[model samples]
Target: MTGSVPVHLEVDRGAVLDGDLVLPPEPRGVVAFAHGSGSSRHSPRNRAVARVLQEAGLGTLLFDLLTEDEERTDAVTAELRFDVPFLAGRLVAAVDRLGARPDTAGAPLGLFGASTGAAAALTAAAERPDAVRAVVSRGGRPDLAGQALGRVRPPVLLIVGGLDTEVLRLNEQAADALSAPCTLRVVPGAGHLFEEPGTLAEAATSARDFFLSTVPGPIGT
Candidate 1:
């Protein structure tokens, strides 16, 4: 477990988002997390996956997609949580920030997105084809990416729970829409949240393997 540092990113003028950046010595690549609806950088599930990736010698950036005030409003309206374009914009900014940092610069980038965040991740990958190396989604709503799906150039892995029937179908559809290399893996008996024993571990393992094979180079060097 390499030590992680708290960092702030200026997504826009007067808008700063908080994140935790962890870089294992000689990390193979850096993966930025886009949490699901109503979730943030502090999400235990994302943090757990991030920890696994870090241990595998990958750098990780887990950041909040919304500010405190925005969350307050979203709690009531439930609108911002589904705003794909807005969320994707923030993710793009985060990727750019990582590129500019000495610690993460020049490293291949991957994205791990859950639920609605998956849609944003796809959109960001489509928008920044040269920067993102790969993408992974867990129980994600990638269908929300719409036409942008065809433009995404990086390989993508979509992990869904077999019990999450609707989302699995949606992921299948999204995979078909993508022109880039895409794969869909369904964890048997797992639900939408992968709360069943060992389900999350399976998903995390899949993510780690996908990133390892897709992202180029050894860690730190």
Candidate 2:
């Protein structure tokens, strides 16, 4: 239970996704990743962050949000990627699947979302307040969550690139609207993709720390 393993998550009869699951011995919590639009379980940036979470004794799941056919269609139409409600429903299904698994059922859950996925994560958190303990958004457009922003009860950490001015401003507005405990961290010299040196690492570390503090452990463990 301490290494990376591949998993198949069935979101519904129509969608079955591939994912990578990494767990430490008796993990304190589990984090599920929602990659940005056009990205998947193989995103190197998300994989890097998952490694950090795994090393910190938190189990991590990086999964694809769409099927191969859907990905191909989305590539052409760019429609499904921005459909926040659809993505949120998928995320909720993923969370339910995780909860039903014996290995992860006992652990509190956290969500780490990037770009459009962040909005999905926030919306999912609101939809399943009892299941999601915390959420972290990286270079995300949380304003896209709209009214769901007011219903997310779990603590949230919004990590943005300082140079990604528009997203930063949007995150600031989302922060003000969030009813839950929320913190906004801006990484200087980084852009929307956090392609700048050391910037992604900074965002990942903040996410790690946020989950560590906010995701509650078992009461008597």
Candidate 3:
């Protein structure tokens, strides 16, 4: 079952972070996951999204932005949600780590993030415009990016729950700030996490399509 699709990897890329890496057989591209507030690589919701993306012929790396000790401290302070610069640095490192991997070298790359992770992803996309091809946000708080929003060049899709009014507004505001080719998709009845079942699937499908459409070639050497 070589081409049957590889499920996961125990890759140690000196990526500066640690977590799960899932790959398909000859993946069409890669999607790196940036977990939301208080979430990590083990997040069930992110895992679900990764599952769908994998089935769509993409590889996924779900890594924790903070170390265990930092996570414990962040849990009490709740300030990690505002640490977009730190998170963005790690994300870019992870993308570089993947780019250096033999198996992932030829694949186009994408970023899938939730909540604060979305802001971090936007920062990374802005910093590494040549590497990351596309971006996706789910109930994300890209507003945290402040003035960095306009720097991202990749096509991005922001998926918000129509019922999550506050988040919907935040996403709308963020969408307006971005200078990239982007869209805001409000999935009706699917509050924040798209916990309403098919809504998440729809988000996943939309994300897959967006990434596939934007990432069809190689980055400059």
Q: How do the residues 104-155 of candidate 1 rate in per-residue lDDT, one tens digit apiece?
A: 8888899999999999999999999999999999999999999999999999
Candidate 2 segments whose C-alpha is farther than 4 A from its true place: 216-221
Which digits, one per residue and each the tens of the lDDT, describe model 2 over residues 102-181?
A: 88886899999999999999999999999899999999989999999999999999999999999999999999999999
The number of clashing residue pairs in each candidate reads 4, 0, 0
Reference-based lDDT, residue 56, model 3: 74
Can you give the TM-score per candidate against the true fold? 0.97, 0.96, 0.89
What shift in Å separates residue 9 of candidate 2 from its native position after superposition? 1.3
Q: Candidate 2 overall Cα lDDT vs. reference?
A: 0.91
Clashing pairs in 2: none
Error of 3 at 146 (Å): 1.4
Off by over 4 Å in 1: 218-221
Stretches off by above 4 angstroms in model 3 are 1-16, 217-221
Q: Give all candidates' CA lDDT scores.
A: 0.94, 0.91, 0.83
In angstroms, the error of model 3 at 64 is 0.7
Candidate achieving higher lDDT, 1 or 3: 1
Q: Pick the candidate with the highest TM-score.
A: 1
